[model samples]
Target: MDSPTILLTNDDGIDSPGIRALANGLSDVGEVTVVAPADNKSAVGRATSSEARVHEHELGYALEGTPVDCVIAGIEALGPSPDVVVAGVNQGANLGMYVLGRSGTVSAAVEAAYFGVPAIATSLYLPGDRWKTVPKPEEYDEAVRATRYLIERGLDNGLFELADYLNVNAPAPENGRTEMRITRPSSVYDMTANHDGETVTLQDNIWQLMERDSYSEGERTDRQAIVEGVISVSPLAAPHSTEHHDALDDLAAEY
Candidate 1:
């Protein structure tokens, strides 16, 4: 079906190397139009502006808002209705269930899902110390490669028919070639908050475990897959659901 039109964006801002790498790689698979945040809006999950200022840029357009705002603007104002929305090639990993709701990269894809458009979110998983220093643009090769692989392989196979979006993560390219694993967001939760005399400190202890190679999860979990130097591909849905509960049904009858 002729090359699809792709709407590319990121929470790291329009000028980030990650987005550039994505745009470049996806160009081989589709017509890529980038509309991303004007400045870093990382972790601003699904936030949007009712009205946003947009500026023309060499890459396409930049919105003065969050990643979700970029998608809204791209689909509604700045560019053609996209065949798919691709977010990130994010600087850091956005793995695990607890982190999804707070990740601008994942949220961009979620917004697209609600619009009835298939989407993909990509991120790079750096080892603990490597994360302290931002990697060079070339370092995003692994993420860009994995994204292209999915775009070419998944789009025509009814992959989106089964899932709203895909959450993809890759370890550094230096890890060498590794197999991609179809996985789920890890259920591990390690958040803790401490109150001091005049301050409160919140920490995600999962990072500590990840650093020590001690974090554990099922074989088909995103966190475990990435830690093992493999690409993680998680099929995700935007909606929330609950199993049938007789108690709730009875309560509804009373009401």
Candidate 2:
């Protein structure tokens, strides 16, 4: 395809360094239009708004809505119909299977899949110690490089035929380089909640768990790949899977 148009978005807002890095990195390969949130909209999943406000940005547009809204707007009204949708260079990784529905980054890509547009969701893995600090745009280099490679070759390489989009997680570039690996969302989940007298505190301990090497599914899983400083690319479909069940059929018959 001739200079494929790329619709770029993210949960971290249009002005985020991660998205800027991605836009700059992918510019030569394709025309990148960034239609992202005006402010941080992280972890909003596939939420949509009947009316979302939009304004112009240097790269493209910034919408006062969720990531999914950006994808929809980009494809429908904002710019040329994109050849592919790219989300993130997210501040944090969207890894395990459980977090998929809660991640605006991945959800944007999923929304694109429903429209039959191939997408790629990319993120950087921040270790537990670095959660308090802001990452530089250059820190996203490895992730952006990986995303650029996929955008350049994915459409022509039969990758989209296999799945709707790809979920990629790259180790922070400062950690040095590692081989890219094809992987799956990890099955592990780590969430804890504490109830106080009048308050409930919820925490996602997956990053902490990772720091201690408390869990490992090895190379086959996204989290494990990031832990080992490897770039992970997992091809996945958008629609939820379904299967016939005799038990459900029998229950329906009795009802």
Best by TM-score: 2
Per-residue lDDT, model 1, residue 203, is 87
Per-candidate TM-score against the hidden true structure: 0.95, 0.96
- Alpha-carbon lDDT, every model: 0.88, 0.90
Q: Encode model 2's per-residue lDDT on 1-255: one tens digit a residue.
A: 769999999999998898999999989988889899999999898899998999998978999999999999999999899999999889988889998999999999999999999999999888876745679877988899899888888899899999899999998676646689999999888799999999999998887787665667777999888887899999999989788999989999999
Candidate 2 all-Cα RMSD: 1.3
Give candidate 2's error at residue 119 in angstroms: 0.2
Clashing pairs in 2: none
User: What is candidate 1's lDDT per residue for 23-128, written digit by digit as tens?
Assistant: 9888879999999999999989977788888899999998899999888888988888998999988988899998899999999999999999999999998776
Worst ten in a row by lDDT for model 2: 210-219
Q: Which regions of candidate 2 deviate over 4 angstroms? A: none
